[model samples]
Target: MEQKQFFTEKPRILIVDDELGPRESLRMILKPYYEVYTAKDGISALEAIKKNPIDLVTLDLRMPGMPGEEVLKHIKNFDPTIEVIIITGYGTLQSAVEAIKYKVFDYILKPFNVSDILSVVKKCIGRRYVSGEIKNVLEKTKRDTKSHSEIYEQITHFLNQLNESCYYFFRRENYLEFVRVLATTLESKDPYTVGHSERVCHYSSLIAEGLGLSPDEKEKLQISAYLHDIGKIGISDIYISKDGPLDENEWAIVREHPIKGIKIISPLGLSSEVIEGIKYHHERFDGKGYPEGLSGKNIPLFARIIAIADAYDALTIGRPYKSPLSKNEALLEIKKCAGSQFDEELVEVFIEEIKKNDREINQMH
Candidate 1:
């Protein structure tokens, strides 16, 4: 099988404008970072796109012939993945509205600031790179029955390339959005697990609040919770949505998810704490978990907290293989496993928070 190359070269960019000054300015600004191309007219721009692999385009709306709107439509029809940002000197509400209809990445007024242009371009390219990689990985997994090791290798390579190319330009908000997108994609694989990550995040946040964690620590924990199950994306949908108990071999494959999850996000420049939380969430308090078997406080605090949240949701939410337990039943199960599968102190904190939430819900009702 041919392995997909992940942004090993500078992304190709096309600048379209009739005015030489604005077109050349854009070319100069982006030339240092990208494989820049330029066109003086819409006809030339269309030809350039057809001939080259253009990742993005900056087009002036007020061009002489072949108006920018017509060019935008052609670009989208040819390759919807190619991001286009509209640059217009004669900005108008109708034109802006029309740009939105065509799904332009951004609309910038002419005489744009140098920093603003660079920032917008970086953000657009960063999004394109990440989204493209994710699509590639997903398509590969769906088409091939590759082994878990092969899948891991593919993900690792893709992430390394993505980090090298785009991490420097990705903003924190963009990273968070990507995490949410990944989490949602993972959940979509199994109908029974819809909203699983968000619920885990909510539960983990409650635990964090009960323990009086600092703001930064809480935020890290939330990101960890959202991404904790990301590795499951590599797992076969047959196993994920299996209606019967997994045999030993199947169980072993399923257990590799945490490590897979780690490999998926480790290169995205998240904090070590967040990565560790995802890696160790399955670890047992008595040192008997798969992957790594650190016992008691040996597990990171975020991991322990997430483990509790994860297990709670699993117990309360019905799955194909087992019926979900009631709230009290799930609480009892958690209490029973405190010393062996969870942290004792954190368990207490989580239970109190659950009861507090119940009280609030009842009061409102």
Candidate 2:
């Protein structure tokens, strides 16, 4: 059977096993479709991973000298993006659970069916290709000082290249994971703002729970909250990490993030609700926000929930221009701005939720 190559370069696969028969069997199965490499044990596997741009590894858990679990940790520490599959004759419930904890793409017992192996390998390679394409889009967007229109065109072209695979890549878990990676990448640009998106997502979920939002609504809101600040990716690091007040010009660039975020993500065919949340998260309830001064209920519901959550995080973490506030002090400020900066009802719900989970919330921060 012939496998269609979706990438210009063949995706690389490394087979690591202590036994010759099982190792060579995997090599034979994968070689025709991928650039395959072989490592007889964990030590050699780590060396091969360093020497080659290996996209995937099929690891045997009981390898001698260095355990496969240890190698998996090193691989993730080196580059968490690389995909892995565990194939072991001695596979046990404990080993499978442990493999999942390390985020292996799949755990398969020995004597795996040929078709099943092929299916999993195909999906893994496809995922890797899609991730690479997205990274390229983001890198080009950041590196090239292109006009907004140009960036949109580039993203749209990349989407077109995905063709039918768009459905597969946007599957629930895959989509959320990719968005988290993008959010993490954006936060990496600023030292003070690390984990900002994840914290905001957590706060937003708490508010959603308080509001009794449907599971579907909660899912969309989670995506929106994580991506609310994605537009900041386009803004220069000088403004993002600045330790002092921004001059009017710097402030202007900072304010453009919402619009930039909308343009960057709108082409990816996301739901309007998700896009609106990103575009309007900074908008205030009293009609004093940027990009659009949408007031009260005029703001999208997801955006309103995210607005309160985003503010709470920023206040607690403290931006470069502001000193950090204690959780109680931040809650007090949020309470004071109820109708002015955030939706009034949502503010009450958020505050109540925070108080209920004070201990857990404190630990999260």
Q: Which candidate leads the pack in lDDT?
A: 1
Worst-scoring 10-residue span by lDDT in model 1: 1-10
Please, what are the lDDT tens digits per residue for candidate 1 over residues 34-91? 8899999999999999999999999888778898889999999999989999887654
lDDT of 2 by residue, 1-365 (tens): 23344565778899999999988888888888788999998889999999999899988888779988898999999899899998867536478667887779887778867777877787677667666677778678869955645555665566565645645644664566556655775566468888999999999999999989898888888888888987776666777788788899998889988888877676567789989999998899999997778898999998998888888888999887898899889999999999998888999999899888987767877
Predicted structure 1, TM vs. truth: 0.61
User: What are the models' TM-scores?
Assistant: 0.61, 0.74
Clashing residue pairs, backbone N/CA/C < 3 A, model 2: none
Over 4 Å off in model 2, which ranges?
A: 1-5, 15-40, 50-52, 58-64, 76-81, 84-127, 137-165, 352-365
lDDT of 2: 0.81
Residue 126 alpha-carbon offset, candidate 2, angstroms: 5.2
**Candidate 1 whole-model C-alpha lDDT, 0 to 1:** 0.84
Cα RMSD of all models vs. native, in order, equals 8.2, 4.8
